[model samples]
Target: MIPVLWHLGNVVVDLVLDVPALPERGGDVLATRTEHTPGGGFNVMAAAARQGLAVTYAGAHGTGPFGDRARAALHTEGIGILLAPRTSGDTGFVVCLVDADGERTFVTSPGAEASLTPADLAELRPGAGDLVYITGYGLLHDSNRAALLGLLPRLDPAVTLVTDPGPLAGDIPTEALETLLTRSDWWSCNAREAALLTGLDDPAEAARALQSRLGRGAVLVRTGPDGCLLHHGGRLVAVPGFAVDAVDLNGAGDAHTGVFMAALARGADPVAAAHRANAGAALAVTASGPATAPDAAQLDAFLN
Candidate 1:
């Protein structure tokens, strides 16, 4: 069977520390809780696998302690990993500190996650009717970016590309971003990312601008709490989000996109898929880390 889901991107473990207040330089603060789990592309693949898809995670990991732990973590999540060994360097990591309001500040270290090459993409080639999810971060790096772009045009028309341009800081070239978006069937982004992409403040406006740029189908703009808006199918529709007690916001968006793609792979309608995605994301933030994402049955139960 063809893989219903394919993720070619960075895989890292995130360590979260929640503090009452974000501390300043030279200030001492105690964290409320410290939680660590697999994050990024690995997290997305794990979430999708739990939703009962045939998922493959193709990326890079180091031979160091963090990489070993990260691979083990992916195994526990039931994600199939196509890992490239890193001869030297630690695996990727994020040190996130969430404040009382649930906002987080991150200090990211891209270690092994940054080492993926075009050679890695060759291992997980797609057949007809497969879906590939590409992260913007992976495409920012030179070696991997060329590899990623090379795979795009060759994608079977039966295949659909879902992209999350996560944090398009100066790393990702503008032309690469445009090319990726131009090739993708569905584009998912949060409010800030939407704004950065379209230069629009309102989420709805951002969706409109993005749709205009792409001009083929819908643009999914994820608004925190207010819900996600889709500008496509000749209309602007909103998928209402559940109000959940958010512990840590890390991986919530990725969880939403993962399950959303799973639903699409199952041939669900766009609106219905969005609802399913919304429920999945709600379940994701209830826990402190990525591994706690709900499975298909659990997400359905939550919906019921």
Candidate 2:
């Protein structure tokens, strides 16, 4: 079988709104624009699929309209949905408020995605050399967290686990968080998450410290439009990113990660993969909507 990229993360709909600025604690503001689409873990799988990597979403989808959208988006992207539709509740959604500077604030209302069991995890069935993508959201909920921890050690040793400590990184229990990072074969996250994990405010320091703990594994700290800091094989290098006028920062990190994993699956060098990821992210941010990572041809054109 071709090496597959399995996403053991939640997929949800995003209700995105464009605003001049964030509202105060007891304030209100009108949105300049509004959009609704499948987001969260979906972005990574979509980006990977765009690069011709076979991808699968091994998470729960609910029984309502939101779940319907998630399933439709996955099918349109040609990504396989590994788990059956969840019945307890509809798939969840997040309200994203984008400010003028492209920063975002999110308010989430979780549903069926927060619930998972050992039985649900059994369907993951990853193959040797397959890539497993884990988002921090999976570790936030009690049920999902237990299921993931139990399934981690059972995964085939040949499978490479990539964990991205998302915005929820701070809320994850210390022991569990450390365990996840220690067990991961590859760790990718933004500068804020790097600090939250390592207690080092400096991105470079956090990258070095985190990479050292991985033994033979690698770590990447994304720095937005400036690019990323990649620490692998005892060397840390700043992989320059393509600078662009960022209209939206949503899905940029996911684009970078999906492209990076696909590159590694295709046997590209780590540094070269990082370069592609950075370029792919730059292209993603230039677009207004999420799930905007470019195809191979677009990436090549940008690089050339």
TM-score for each of the candidates: 0.94, 0.97
Model 1 TM-score, 2 decimals: 0.94
| Reference-based TM-score, model 2 | 0.97
Candidate 2 on 1-304: residue-level lDDT in tens?
6899989898999999999999899999999999999999999999999998999988878999999999999999999987889877999999999899988888889988888777888656688989998889988988888888888878888888999989888888776677777778889999999998889999999999898777346899998888999888788899998879999998899999999999999989889999999999999998777789998888889999
> Candidate 1: lDDT of 50?
85
For candidate 1, the 10 contiguous residues with the lowest summed lDDT are 116-125
- Pairs of colliding residues, candidate 2: none
CA lDDT for candidate 2:
0.89
Query: What shift in Å separates residue 13 of candidate 2 from its native position after superposition?
Result: 0.4
What is the Å distance of residue 241 in model 2 from its true position? 0.8
Shift of residue 107 alpha carbon in model 1, Å: 1.5
Displacement of residue 179 (Cα, Å) in model 2 is 2.2
lDDT of 2 at 241: 85
Cα deviation of 36 in candidate 1 (Å)? 2.7
lDDT of 2 at 165: 81
